[model samples]
Target: MLELILALRNALVQQGLELRAQEASDWQGEIPLPADIARFYRDIGPDNCNLATAGNSFFIPALARLWRMQAGYRWHGISGERLTDWHDDWLAVADQGGDPFIFETSSGKVLHDRHGGGSWQPAPLFDSLEQMIACLATFDAVWNSAGEDIFLDDYSVNPRHRERLIDALIPLLNSRSAAQSLADELGW
Candidate 1:
């Protein structure tokens, strides 16, 4: 089993790919999270195509960033966004029980827990598609279009950080017991 893991890892790396693990806080719970929910969390990242959970370990691609790490997450890529206000607004919306469509952060305040932490604001009065389109069109014409340069500039400073990012590769690949256990549990 371990040999198979090693072989799989080697095959992947030979193809210029890496098997990186993106940690999830949900997997830290005593009971395993629902597979559907876990997969949803894993999909928060652009590159995370598969999600598997064994015991407390949830395996996912390491390239996931804060934006793609959680469900219904949003961010504003403005250059001078501040954290204090962001948190305040998030809490405000959360207090209102509204789910916000977009999350915005600027240069001054770095969003903490980009993967899946910090506070959230619930979006009010825009839950419906019509409301969402209306809200977005307004925002697009007012804020997004005018501030496009600042947003682009922020990403340009560190473009890699904005996209799926994997900093390192696992030096040792495959855990045979783990593979066997997974197969056994799945009846594979």
Candidate 2:
């Protein structure tokens, strides 16, 4: 978890993004983390929730809502001009087919759900959030090179932080494929 947070901090700064910190007190009982999710915050400090870049943001309830879309939109370019937030769940987390949202299901399995036609086409995307976060380490590389023309379905765990994130990963994983995919995706 710390590994991911550090990466986020560095990534935000690299992108010249602004940082906003949230405290547990700020939640004001409006949004709360269950035990499973609460543990993740302990490392980074529960009081500290939302983090953002200049044009992007990540808040707890975590990148997605329960069995629904997250932000429901995506930036068309690095300049982030064509922003659109959907009023419904089809775009849960992001534009289903137009932009892929690799998100956690209510059952804890990560799924890739997107839409361009009119409905969500959800497919198994990852086994665990930890595994997904690990794979996202390559996001900077992909974004730097490809921008909007890329598919980020592959996932892997960094050997250096494997054990470190496992505790957090185990609680949220519901399928073995997420683990298997890690090995298959990054040759772990």
Candidate 3:
């Protein structure tokens, strides 16, 4: 896991992508997590994310809400199992290539719907949060870090989203040194 996360960090740095986090104190009064989920956070916390960087959204504790909110709002289709309803037994944790990482509410299952997010064949790519994180970290290292053309070839959802994502990330690519410094400072 350490090796995988490091590879992702290195890839992002090579591409000038910046990761940020807030202070631990910022997480103090935030919405409480489920006992199980909170336990997971306690075990991994900010360290669980590949996107984490010093002062970036992923590394900071206070910004967990923002991350969770983004995850929660992703109401795309989920696994291919029994519970297929939009929001019934799942919570979104992350999204890549239009597919979402989801947590089963009733059963503590973590799943990644990589089949276009719900083409009716919702097979789970992973069964644990750690596995999901690893998948994302690997994807970041292998795909998103390469360049626009590569990202487009693989993760492009549509022309609009593609253009917007490229536009948003290109600036980070343009300013690599600053972002690299932050990652180095954060020991990411």
Candidate 4:
């Protein structure tokens, strides 16, 4: 996991982005982070780099700004009538615009909830935090290599670049189907 995180940092640096590491003391939440998640925050947090620059609105906030789902609802002043099914233990680790990628503390799984929909039942996106990081790194590398204008007007990757991305991600993710699924999710 540490190796994967370092690889991600290196990939971001290759794209000419700066990263900020977090101090151990910066994490003051009572909720404990999984080891790999903690390592990610310690080694690379508060970075301005958008991991989903390929026509996606994803952003992972710094460790200091990380909060749980319940806190987010309260912070946004979401009324009870607007609330949906949410686990208090799920942390909002990252987001694609308002849709959140949540980390379930008890199950050690990552979930993604598409906001502005029906019941807020998030589905499993990644098996673990490491998988999510790897997917991001793979996508970042392929998208950047394809060039800045890789995405079309509708925010979908150009067909050529989409194939390139799928090809590049297959071996890293160990499944062509998985690669295709990720590309589709990223709006390929």
Candidate 5:
């Protein structure tokens, strides 16, 4: 997991994005973060790197900001009513636009939920945090290297680049189906 996190940091650096290390004390939440997740925040914390594709904006907040974000997702803004489906063990580690990528403390699996779905039900996205970081690193690589011909005027990925992305993701994800699912989720 540390290797994957470093690789992701290196990949982002190659793209000229800067990331700063976070202190362990930064994570003062009542619910303890999984070790790997905590390591990620400590090694490659938040940044405004614009990890945006035509499909989604991948944003991972700093630990300090996580609670507010989680609270909003867990409770209705207007009514301040708690969402029955939102679980205490599910911590939102990242987000695709408004949709959250949740870390399940009990299962050690990463799940994704579509925003405005009106429920907290999330689908399995990755077997572990390591896999999720690997996918992100692969996506960063492919997205940066995609030629102009691989993108339409609207910046959506062309089919060629989409195939390239899936190919790149396969080995990192260790499953063709998982790679394909990630591409589909990215709308590639």
Candidate 6:
């Protein structure tokens, strides 16, 4: 997996693209990691990603998202049949020049590069509780708007599978919330 990601990173570098890494506290600014990639997974949570690790390498989903400037909200586990399925889907999109966005059999898709270019430099979009609330509220609208169309449209609609992904993602999101809170209090 790491090798695959590296290969993609090499390809993107050849194209003169870059990733940014970011601090959790800087909600209104881009961190050091790829902002576009971070924004795609931003819904999943912030802790699962590290700019230092992602900045120099290419992750297929990240690459796909970067390539497409996709903000689609698809999430897949690292070790599972679902992961394999998602990877296959990602490759198909990447191969087709369909835009490097991540898609899942469960969730429909999240458009990352809706702006026509991936964000090599992304800014954090939150800083205070108000900011956080606003960000969450906006995302909530996005999340709810999709409703079952993305999550419950097919395999992801299965109780076990849907619950599994959400369950896994919730803790990560919570941890992100806590971490952000701490960072804010410390003036980070």
The lDDT of model 1 is 0.28
CA deviation > 4 Å runs, candidate 1 = 20-60, 63-188
Between 1 and 6, whose lDDT is larger?
6
Error of 2 at 114 (Å): 2.0
Report the C-alpha lDDT of model 5 over 116-188, residue by residue, as the tens digit: 8767789899887657765765676677787467587877688787788889888878878878988888667
Q: Model 4: how far is 145 from its true place, Å?
A: 3.2
- When sorted by TM-score, best at the front, the candidate numbers are 5, 4, 3, 2, 6, 1
RMSD to native, candidate 2: 11.0
Tens-place lDDT per residue, model 1, 1-188, is 44543554444344333334344663533333444323323432213322211112112223333333332333334543344434422211110112233322211111112223456432233222222222222222222223334234434312222111111111121344433332333212
lDDT per residue as tens, model 4, 1-188 = 66776876676666655567876566656666556567767776635446754656567666766644335442344543424466666777777667778888778788887777755778887877656765666677677677757867876678888888888778667888988987876667
Candidate 6 local Cα displacement, residue 149, angstroms: 20
User: Candidate 4, residue 44: CA error in Å?
Assistant: 3.9
TM-score, cand. 2 vs. native:
0.36
Angstrom error of the Cα, residue 2, model 2: value is 8.8
Better structure of 4 and 5 per TM-score: 5
Candidate RMSDs in Å, in order, are 20.1, 11.0, 12.7, 3.3, 2.6, 18.6
- Write candidate 6's Cα lDDT for 92-157 as tens digits: 112112323233322333222222343321123222212232222222333334445534444333
Order of models, best lDDT first: 5, 4, 3, 2, 6, 1
Best by lDDT: 5
What is the C-alpha lDDT profile of model 3 across 1-75, one tens digit per residue? Answer: 656546545554454443443344434323344454554444434333434211222222223552443332333
Cα lDDT, all candidates: 0.28, 0.37, 0.42, 0.68, 0.74, 0.30
Which is better, 3 or 4, measured by TM-score? 4
| Candidate closer to the true structure by TM-score (higher is better), 2 or 4 | 4
Identify the superior model by lDDT, candidate 4 or candidate 6: 4
Return whichever of 4 and 6 wins on TM-score. Answer: 4
